[model samples]
Structure formats: C-alpha cells, structure tokens
Target: MIDIPDSDRQLIDQAIFLPMLLTVLQRDLAAIDKGSFKLKQPYQISIEAIIRDVQKDLAAAKRYLHKNNIKIIRGRSENNFTFYMVMYKGGEEKRSYFNDKIRNNVEDLLDYYLVGRQEER
Candidate 1:
C-alpha cells in the first residue's frame, strides 16, 4: 500500500468530489430557473452562491495538485466500482470506489457546502 499524506489525500478528494458537486449544483440551478416555483429566486440565489464557493475550492485544489506534481485521472468503471489513477511525485496508485458510495459522498459534501457552512456564518 502506498502511503499518501492526509493533506494530499484530502486535496485529491476535493479534486474529485468538488467537480461532481459543482455539476450537480449547476443542474439544480437550471431546474430551478425553469421550474414553476412561486419563489424561485431564493433557491436560485442560494444555489448560485454555493456554486461560486465550490468553484473557488476546486480551483485551489487544482492549483495545489499542479504545484505538487500530482495528477489524478479517471479510469474505467466496472460493475459497481469506479477507478482512479493518482500519480504523485514519482509514485502512482490506483484507487477504486463504489459508485453508490461516490454519490452518497458527493451528496454529503453538497449538504455541507450548501447548508452546513452557511449556518456557521
């Protein structure tokens, strides 16, 4: 097993999950814009705010990865698992995740960024 520093692992995770979260939020924003909600403005505003925050975090993660000579590439998915290839420094590691687990994780991140973080402010 390749030992990866916790901080690098976290940045890598953000690199993977943040984009997914942003994509989901963008889709939700589009739905809110088109849906016949009586008060769509609030929902749209909330989602837009979250989107901006996620984009900032994503950009930071990308910058860190580049600066540290790290690369993450999505690999083929099989059955219930999705694979990722992480290359850092001179070492490479392959990681696999269950598809449903990925969805659940991204959902958790979305909730944190959208509601939990906002509550802290």
Candidate 2:
C-alpha cells in the first residue's frame, strides 16, 4: 500500500477525483469521436460537457480546500503523467508535500473508471 499523510488527503482527493472523473469523460468522448454508435456530435458534446463540468468540480474542490484550511493550487489535465499545473497554495511549500498513496489511488480510480468500464470491444 502507498503511504501518505492524512492532512494531505484533501489535496489528494482533489487530485484523484477530478482525473478519475475526466478520464471517464474522455473515454466517452473518444467513442463519440469514433462514431461507434450514436451520432458524431456526442463525442464533441460529451467532451464539451466534461470541460464545463470540470470548472464546477474545480470550484467545489477549491471551496473544500479552503474549508479545510489548506491552500489549493489548480491544474488543468493535459494528458501527461504530470498533467496538472500549480494554481495556488495554502500553508506549506509545495515542495514540502508529496503523496504516492494519493497518486496510486488516483491511478487505480482512473483505471477502474476508465478501462474497466463498459466498452464496445
């Protein structure tokens, strides 16, 4: 199991939740792009919806971070392992914090939510 600080779980949760959420959206968008079943517009529409919803999720996450007395740095997912950018900070130096558990847990969630979902394979 991965080890991480409890204090950082909030941050980790932010990281994990959004990516997992987005990946599922991306998969649906990909299917839409493929014109697999429905009209070609769903892929584009789903992606657009996901993008808009991401803003909402980020806002909720930002508020959650504030309520927990932690500063939040926002990042946009860019399809890289290091996809997120620094948006803000609260109490500690960004370098002073790290969480592999959160990372692995996020990977697990993404895999489950993305690859393990129903697909037309």
Candidate 3:
C-alpha cells in the first residue's frame, strides 16, 4: 500500500513540487555526510552546486532552503535506503514520502489529484 499525502499530491500538479522533489533528491544524493553510517550511503548528494542549479530551474530543491542551509543525515534503516534530513536553524520540516516511490508517483498522482479535483467540482 503506497499512501501519498494529499499536500504532496496537490504539489505534483503545481508544476513546482515534483521537480522540486527531484532536484532536492538529486542535490542531496550527491553529497552524503562524512559521518553517515551508510557506506556508499545507499545514495549520493552534492549540496552547493544544487543551489546554483536551482537558479536555472525553480525546482532545484534548495529553493526553499535558500541561504537557510540544508543538511542530510543517513539514519538506521534495514533496507537499502538512505534517510534524508532537511533541516535549518528553526528545525526540520515534515515529509510524508521519502522513498523513490514519491518520484514515481509524481505524474500519476498529479494527474489523478488535480484532474480528479476538477471533475469533482
């Protein structure tokens, strides 16, 4: 059962969220923290360049975190998964979906959620 949050579902169609998620995933994956427990960390990340990349594309992931600073942490997970922690001085935000499935669900969920909402009205 893949349960996607409604907010995320809405964002998928906004022409901003899906790309935002991918850019973030790509950016974060490029640079895994040094002390991270995962050897090879099951993922890769590059923090700085991503911010620069975002300027070209609004969905560069770090847009929201602009100058706020973003951090990634690999947590303890049994599966081949790398946990991501997006934080700032205020605290960390909440994410309903973290796995690759979130990316996959982008188009489908966007079509379903947005189109469906239109039909409902």
Candidate 4:
C-alpha cells in the first residue's frame, strides 16, 4: 500500500469528485430549463452560481494535480464498490470506495456549495 500525503489525498479526491458534481449540476440546470415552472429564474440563478463556484475549485484541483504530476483514473466497479487508480510521484495505488459513500459525499458537497458556504458569507 502506497502512503499518500493528506494534502495530495485531498486534491486527488477533489480531482475525482468535482467533475462528477459539475455534471450533476449541469444536468439539473438542463432539466430546470426544460421543465415548466412558474419560477425557474431563481432556481437557474442559484444553480449557475453553484456551478461557477464548483468550476473554480475544480480548476484549482486540476492545476495542482498537473503541477504535481498526479493522475487519477476511474476503474471498474464490482457490486457496491467502485475502484479508482491513483498514479502519483512514480508510484501507483488502487483505492476502492463504496457506491453509497460516493453518493453521500457528493450530496454533502452539493449542500455545502448550495447553502452551507453561502451562509458563511
């Protein structure tokens, strides 16, 4: 097992999950655009704001990964677990995460971007 530093691990996690979060937000925005709603503007504006915030973070994560020569790849899934391969600093490590854990983490991130962080400002 290759040991990963906490900072790199955080960046790797962001690199893996931020794009997925963006995809979900984009799809949600598209659905809102297509659906008939009396007040779509508010929802659209909120989602757009969240998308911009996520994009900025994602860009930073990508830059960190590139500058540090780190790469992460999604591997095959088996049952309730999905595999990920991380290539960092001339070493490789395989990590497996439960599907539900990933979903929950993403949900938490969405909540933070949508509401939690907003309250801090």
Candidate 5:
C-alpha cells in the first residue's frame, strides 16, 4: 500500500470529485449557452455564480495537490499510481484498454483547473 497522510486522502477526494461537479456545471452551462435567448438575466447570473463557486473550490483543490506534488498523471507518484491502478486493474483486459482513456479523463479534470472549474459544500 502506498503511504500517504490522512489529509492527503481529503485532497485526493477533492481532486477526483471536484471535476465531477464541473462536468455537471458545464453541462448545464452548455444548455444556458445554447438557450441564451430564453434564459432571463437573473437566471444566467445565478448560474454564473454557481460556476464561480465551483471554480473557487476547484482552484483550492488544485493548489493543495500541486503543493503536495501529487500529480494527476500516471507513474508520477504513489498517488497517481494508486489512482490509475485501482481504476484500471479490475481485470487484465481492462488494464490494456484504458491507458489513455482513464488517464485522459483525469487530465480533463486537471484541465478544469487550468481553464478554471466541486466540493461537497
């Protein structure tokens, strides 16, 4: 087992889950983007506020992960190794298929930080 601080688990959870929030937000944002003619100004403002909050949480999580050197890429550290392995190693065939797919998904989450994008609260 990889050795990591308990606080790191919280960080890891943030890293993994926050982008999920972004995905939902982005989905709704897309709808708003397309239906801009239909949505009222106040509704758009509310959605933008939610996006800002998600982005703030995303930035904080990314800062913690970066400060700790826990990269989101595979083979970079024990954290990445565990994350990729736990996800990819369910079966032999499963491992071979997702080298890029799974890693890319994580990269997409990281991209949210780059572009600006969770949290339970």
Candidate 6:
C-alpha cells in the first residue's frame, strides 16, 4: 500500500491537482471552441474570454513555487512497483490537516462555478 504523509499531501495537491485542474479547463476551452458555431452571438465571446482567464490563473498557480517548493522522489519496491513521495520546504515535516481546509475552500469555488449549484431564493 502507498502511504503519503500529511505534509506531502499538501504538496501533492499543489503539484498534481493544479495541473489536473488546468487540464480540465483546457478541455472545456477546446469544447467551447469546437461548439462556438452553435452558441448565441452575445454569449460566445464572453464565455471564451472567461475560460481563458481561468486558464491563466491555473498557469500562475503552477509557477508559484517560490516558498513551498515541491519535488517528488521515486523508489522501487522489492516487487518492482514504483512509489513516489512528495517533499517540500518552508514548513514543519509533520502531519496536519490544515491543508485540507484550504483544499476544501478551493473545491467549494470549483463546485460553485463548474458544478452550478444554486441557492434557493
């Protein structure tokens, strides 16, 4: 079984999850480009522009490693399966769930926009 320390989980979330989110945004942008032919005139440009801005933000996140610089180390098990661990700087090397709170906030924003949940009036 693969086990990740809590500290590493935060770094993993940044190094892996941000890129995954960017990939999703890119896919959405591609679909928008492909389907623009059917979108109404007034909404097409605005929607594409918004998506482009989000892509930019994700790109920025990928580059913002000035403090908690992250790296992944890999090792081979006796059975030959490769395992990876995340390492980072600028914090204690202990398990803490504080990053989970931050991740939840980010997820809430994503759910609000991408998942389109609405509040009752």
Pairs in steric clash, model 4: none
Write the residue-wise lDDT of candidate 1 on 36-106 in tens digits: 99999999888999999999999999999999999999999999999999998889999999999999999
lDDT of each: 0.94, 0.53, 0.44, 0.92, 0.56, 0.50
> What's the true lDDT of residue 1 in model 5?
46
For each candidate, C-alpha RMSD in Å? 0.9, 7.9, 13.8, 1.1, 9.8, 8.3
Model 3 C-alpha lDDT per residue in residues 1-121, reported as the tens digit of each score: 2344554334323333445444654545554554465565343333343333434444434443454354433344335443444343545643344446545665454454335534766
TM value for model 5? 0.51
Q: Which stretches of candidate 5 lie over 4 Å from their true place?
A: 36-39, 74-121
Evaluate residue 83 in candidate 4 and report its C-alpha lDDT on the 0 to 100 scale.
99
**Candidate that scores best on TM-score:** 1
- Lowest summed lDDT across 10 adjacent residues in model 2 is found at 88-97
Q: 1 or 5: which has the higher TM-score?
A: 1
lDDT of 6 by residue, 48-121 (tens): 54456546654554465444475554434334233445455533232233445545645654564354533311
Candidate ranking (TM-score, best to worst) = 1, 4, 5, 6, 2, 3
Query: What's the candidate order when arranged by decreasing lDDT?
Result: 1, 4, 5, 2, 6, 3
In angstroms, the error of model 2 at 90 is 9.1
Candidate 1 residue spans exceeding 4 A from truth: none
Supply the global lDDT for candidate 1: 0.94
Best by lDDT: 1
Better of 2 and 4 by lDDT: 4
Q: What's the true lDDT of residue 23 in model 4? A: 90
Error of 1 at 108 (Å): 0.8
Give the alpha carbon lDDT tens digit for every residue of 1-121 in model 2.
2233565565656654676557766776776777667567755864665456565666777676666555434444333333223333423333222345446665665464334532523
The 10-residue segment of model 3 with minimum total lDDT is 7-16
Q: By TM-score, is 2 or 3 better? A: 2
When 5 and 6 are scored with lDDT, the better candidate is: 5
- lDDT by residue (1-121, candidate 5, tens digit) is 4555577656665666566666766776677777847646765676677667667877997897676566553233343333332121122111122335545655565565435533423
